[model samples]
Target: METVDVIVIGAGVSGLAAARLIARGGRRVVVIEARDRVGGRVHTDRSGGHITDRGASWIHGIHESPVAAAARAFGMPMVEFTVGGYQPDSRPLTYFDARGRRLEADAVRQYAADIRTLNAALAKIIAGAGAEATYGDAVERALAEQDWDAERKERVREYNDRRAQEQYGVGMGELGAHGLDDDTVNGDEVVFPRGYDELATNLAAGLDVRLEHLASQVDRSSEGVTVVTDRGVFRARQVVITVPVGVLQAGDLLIEPPLPETHRRALGLLRMNAFEKVVLRFAERFWDAGVYGIRQLGDEGEWWHSWYDLGRLHDEPALLTFAAGPAAVATRTWADEDIVASTMAQLRRLYGDTVPDPTSAIVTRWQDDPFSRGSYAFMLPGSVGADHDDLAEPVDGVLHLAGEATWGDDPATVPGALLSGHRAAQNVLGIDIPVSELWA
Candidate 1:
């Protein structure tokens, strides 16, 4: 049996980050990954001349993001992610009715304003009602207000419903009750110039990562922890689990002596959010003028929220599309051909005859992948307080859990994931290392 000072499971960004930190401490560490490649959701496909990220395309924030800090340290460039305004040819769009006719822009803007007001009002109600009332309940009550008109009010209700559905995989009723409406993600996000996966690869570079080794069970009852894989068994003083929240909820990975009920309950309460990316390589750039961003059809349940050009990316001129919220459900379950077909159909609707079939397309099914069941973790309704606390705590001083999902308070970004790894390493090593020192 191969033995090490520390064993990190799931060689995603978080796992790799933890392994790097622990190994740098002069502790013998081994990272076991289920997938053939490293970087879980931070996958970069270089099959063609251009490089595209199939998983995480954005760095989110440059100043605060630890992943961004690491990238800059490695001499990688960071680019500002802008959708429109620079390109005169670029036309921003508003959601249209079921008919082909575009909805009134003024009405749409007013509708959005109304929704923000309603969310504020609803927030007050939720605060007073404690955690009992669901976000849907608040929304419903807010819609009944006397300030808005009946027709416009109806539109507002429909818009809110669709937005809620589009934002969360579950319905509006699930929001605040069983889902996350209170969960706030900052709108200002950044992207990596090279690729997000480069950060992961750079972090894992020089570290010992055992690829294609999936940990089936973890036994931490003895003095050391035993990680069981199909190929062999490895022992270590401590184990760090950085798999997705969905994988933990699947209850497939066995833990001997079993985790405490608190941690188990946290796994149930905290859920993984579906955020997928589709990379397309076209023969020619139809929207060739500027940083073109195209919003896919079925914006109601759209899998493709928006696509942008790779001009800032000097390597390849491809389009990277992101799918999140309710739109991600179909994409999560979509087959290879189905994904391409649906995307092409969406492109046809948007660009008419201009959009051509992609020369090659790469679809990443993180949800379906056994190693990582979903993109990343998000707290559901009723998941705050102790649930989030338990999710981050180490078990028996032997088995430790850390990942994007376990990052409480901090936004679930790549930087947070990397920080979570460093935190987990500190827990295993029985040291309280500051975040700044870890990076330094």
Candidate 2:
């Protein structure tokens, strides 16, 4: 059996980050990944001269994001989009209703006000009724208190639902009322015109990474830890399990003697959400090229609610549709032909009847993937602040866990995963590294 100072599971950003830091500290490390390639959920696929990100795409905080720093270090070109901006030539986001009517200034203002009212009501509910309240319940209470008519109420509700789905990857009912209030690194978001997976590729450089090695079990002892994989077994003094929350929840990798009660409970308190993307390549640019994204309230729930103009990023006549929460789950049951047809119908509703069929299309089914059962993690309604900390705690100083799920403030982001890995490395090395330096 091969042995090392540390054995890292999953070669995603988190595992790669941990291995890199530990190896830089003069400790031998090896990363075992189930996938044939690196970058678990940061896959970038190219087909017919078009590049599409099947997994994670954006650097949510370019200035402070470790992924962005890695991209810069790797010399990857990035493009920035002004979110929610409405300049005539540089419009980033445009909202439309079921009839394809663009949301005017007055309606947009009303929606913002309604959202503010809803958030304030939710905060009050959390303060009075505690953290057990669901975001859906809070929104309902707030909407009930408003004196709007049925049409306005329905419109606001739909907008709220879309926002919640996009942010949480689940409906408001399943999301905690206080979940959206968590702090995260703040900066302008950017995208890699080439691919986001380049960041992971650069991070994994010079590291001992074993692909197609699926970890089946982890046996921990007072002295060290043993990791059993489909290929073989490896032992190490320390193990960093950086798999996604969905993989852990699915019990894909068994832990000998099981995890501690608190850890198990904490895992249960966190929920992995479903989010998927579908990319379509058309013969010509049928949609407006100036806009970065199009948000539509569709009558049929089959098509995606948001469409990203890939042309703006790479000058390709492609559009990527994003579906989250229930819509994403529902898409899992659709066949490619059916999904393509439905998407075309939805596009026709927005771009008129002359819309052309896509020459090529690609769909991402993260929910159905065995390695990643869902997109990412979110807190349940009853979860406390310490839940993520408890999840991150090392077991016997031999078994350490790190991933986006273990990151409390910025869960479900690439930078969050990287930060969690750095924190895990710090725990194993017994060293102090500034939080900012991890990204730098």
Full-model lDDT for every candidate: 0.68, 0.79
Which predicted model would earn the best TM-score? Answer: 2
Candidate 1 per-residue lDDT over residues 1-440, each given as its tens digit = 99999999989878988888788788999999888999987887776556677776665435465665677677767677633211111244434443334446675566557767776777666665546656677677877764777766665565554445434444466555424433443443467666778777777788899999978899897598999998899999999998887777786677787888978888777666665666777777775355345432233324544566766566455776655556567566667677777767766665576677888877777667776676666555665534554777888788898887777655355666777888898887777766544445
Q: Which stretches of candidate 2 lie over 4 Å from their true place?
A: 82-92, 127-129, 183-185, 298-303, 435-440
lDDT score, candidate 1, position 426: 89
lDDT of 2 by residue, 255-302 (tens): 986889989999988888887777888889887657787777545533
| Pairs of residues clashing in candidate 1 | 60-190, 166-326, 179-381
For all candidates, what are the clash counts? 3, 0
User: Least accurate stretch of 10 residues (summed lDDT) in model 1?
Assistant: 82-91
